[model samples]
Target: MTTALVPPLAACAPVGVFDSGVGGLSVLLEIRCQLPAERLIYVADSGHAPYGDKPPAYVQARAEHILAQLRRAGCKAVVVACNTVTGLSIQALRERHPDWPIVAIEPAVKPAVALTRSGIVGVLATRNTVASPGLARLIAAHAAGVRVLPQACPGWVERVERGELDGPETEAAVAQQVRPLLAVGADVLVLGCTHYPFLRPVIERVAGPSVIVLDPAPAVARELARRLAQAGLAAPGPAPGDVAFWTSGDLAQTQRVIALLWGQAVQPQRLPDDPA
Candidate 1:
């Protein structure tokens, strides 16, 4: 008796993608690159920014609300691009939408562990993501004998939201979180938060020439393509796809941030306020 999945929408119906903030653009870019035929509908839950520190219940509720909104918008599939929400609530999400082909993101720990030459892997994520039981299990299962270091990046998300990619303070923040891992022989640093990928230049600068900075967006994009194909949801290709954005934060601010992160100007649509 959970809500069953709705019938497949048109091939042209947009794919729904969401995150707590614009950080999801990293994932969106990959998806766009991989499946240029399918239009996208993205929502940034900026009003509740940084789900990383929120209680699980709060993040879960917001995730559910956004999913519901996307479904109502005739989306063919949905991508949960927020690691904090995915690690903590993916099962609940699947249970609620029994047949939806939802592609969720996770920290690139397995790949990082595999790519590490020094046997030490570092993961930088939000507080809640670092503490997530899912991440702990992932590390336990795949990181055998490897030293896995989890660092909670407190301000990276906010800085990205503010369009601060690299500056003195941003460089300092990246160095503060990364130097310890590099010093301890971590040759691979996984960008555990979607937001972190947007700050890759600073991360690379801080981690130096030897460390490999990894983001799971490409893998996520491939998986999404597979899911869409399996579900017969892939939009007809050859024709370029379009993007529509919605946010619960300041429209102008969100627009500016999305443009900076997304590499083009986008006119974001506003979501209707829910009285509930």
Candidate 2:
């Protein structure tokens, strides 16, 4: 009698990652690098791009739609890779899906406090993220005795979403945003929004070599790994896994953005605007 061979543990279903736009690609890239054996499914909700400026209720509704679609795709877990959504609606999502393993991003205030030699750290984030009470609580708890300066770049997210990495406009914007913080003796800058990392070069140019820039993607990935391991859902390693892309906006533009961000061509499948 012939026996059936079992598939390796690394070949499991993909983890789901979602963001308002292309910004989440930064987080997805980190997760892919850290957990190469695990597959990933990424959805860019570009139909509602730039969640940073949207109303809290609208952002929450969009998050719910995205999560439901991801759940239907058989995701092992979902990562709220956008800081705005994380700060605004993550608790609601957790309460609604208590058993689902969800990971959310927050500012790296704690880590920045630990690393800052000047005791002054600057945070560049969206309006929503900077104004969040969740972020306020985090600062109160972890950033004790550490001077924290928060700046909200009104159109920064939109510029990044449009694939504007470094240009005269971007450089000027960075300078305008970082100058005040630098003047106040900020030695470290926290990229509090996922999209902000894409403009790191501009920010670095403005802040100069004396300053250090921190992206929270790596820390977020580590937390994800810990949670997966604790839940006995970690993928066994050895081989690289596949990645599937989906978008709710222009597929061609989304594909280009994905390729630019990930260094790999992505042919994004279209999802219904009003997914039932």
Candidate 3:
């Protein structure tokens, strides 16, 4: 019989970040920028890319599985960097691990509501996030009487997953979703999905110079910093921490795209097969 060794949990343990795909790299970048001292462990569940279009139950299951893997890595805290999962599963996850420091992302609706000059804000997100009741509740809470248009960007996540940041087809797809919102006088566009940030230039070109695009990753990072301090899980440091990558997708392909998005080369390991 083989005994498995588990990493010891401590304030210095690496923070775990999970996303449906490379989109979560956007959030990871923010966390890295904000908390340079903390070691980071990131998982891109790319085999299940674009959780935005998946059913809530399916996304919830995948989220649970990935979180289990992160916990097994002995993460001090976990960040659900995928907005779709945050929308669909965050509450359940928090309930399941009440004492764990889990930070989740949501659309920047409150900020969009405040920033919209035309009182019309456009939210570009995954289908699942747009359809989730949590988004509706969020709009109701912060966007009262404001025209908060929820635009479900179907192909955006896949485009980013394939490392297609800019191209005619990508532009067309982004324009197809962005124009209508602009036509309707939405002066502020909120990137509700982490992957959407990679498409910001295209989105901005379609939206024109007058529009404001908001990414919530920076804010999420700040919130994470606060949470870690509150929980006394902040890493003590003078040295910059390193990042480890894992994926449940093709290792070579995942590594390539991650290098493209992350602006450097990184070798990503394949996730272990599910236990029997």
Candidate 4:
């Protein structure tokens, strides 16, 4: 009989996180808040900025590429912090890397259903994420009888990635996309994409005070913490862990956005398309 080998806890490396752009920083921020002693490696595949419109195969390929890079960088676990990518590629990733701890983001429909007073919840996400059968099943299982409105803000992610939060164009886009949901009496809105949290102010303004917007960052952070603890991979605390960032797009622009979002200077390393 063949014996299965076990990996030691010390061999489990830093947590790896990826997104199509800076939006994943929202999730990173949350993770840092919850697990201050755990090191993190974040990658922004900004060259492929909006994965929502891309084919499933393309998203999967990009995700696989990034995961390989993270593994090479000594990451023992990964988080698919983007909803579109998570929706399309997480299952395949888990299948391929069965030993690695993986956490993924999904729309907060269950929580929205639980919190809504009007029985109508709105989800603002990419077409790819909203259209996924996984999302449909989640709604069917956890939110039966509750009205779930999914709105795909096609250009919203692009605008947010460019650090354009509040302008005439952004305001107009937010208002246009949210009007129909509000019309249908949606009192709770889910910021379904990791990137969408950065646009919270605009979304709130468009949806009005009567509506509540929930960002899944806090929950994602909590889950990451739980997974690390369960796997005996949680880092001990005394000093804070280091955070390193990489991007496949313009390094300067990516650094600028990171600094803006993180409220500190960020010098992100630029990685090649095939960095091995």
lDDT of 4 by residue, 77-141 (tens): 78999998877877888888888788998899999999999999999999999988767877898
Candidate 3 deviation (Cα RMSD):
3.3
For each candidate, the alpha-carbon lDDT, in order, equals 0.89, 0.85, 0.89, 0.86
lDDT, ranked from best to worst: 1, 3, 4, 2
Give a tens-digit lDDT track for model 2, residues 25-77: 88999999899888899888887888888999999999988887877777777
lDDT digits (tens) for residues 148-250 of candidate 3: 9999988889889999899899999999999999999999999999999999999999899999999999988998999888777788886999899999988
The alpha-carbon lDDT assigned to residue 20 of candidate 2 equals 89
Model 3: CA > 4 A from native: 1-9
* Model 4: per-residue Cα lDDT at residue 189: 98
Error of 4 at 234 (Å): 0.5
Using lDDT as the measure, name the better of candidate 1 and candidate 3: 1
Give the TM-score ranking, best first.
1, 3, 4, 2
Among residues 3 or more apart in sequence or in different chains, the pairs in candidate 1 whose N, CA or C atoms overlap within 3 Å are none
TM-score of 2: 0.93
Please give, for residues 1-276, the per-residue lDDT of candidate 1 as tens digits.
534444344667789999999999999999999899989999998878899999999999999889888988888889999999888999999888877789999998888888989999999999999999889988998999899999999999999989999999999998889998888899999999999999999999888898899999999999999988887778877898989999988899999999988889999887656323
Worst 10 residues of 1 by lDDT: 1-10
> Model 2, residue 139: what's the lDDT?
92
- By how many angstroms RMSD does model 1 differ from the true structure? 1.6
lDDT of 3: 0.89
Per-model TM-score, in order, reads 0.96, 0.93, 0.95, 0.94
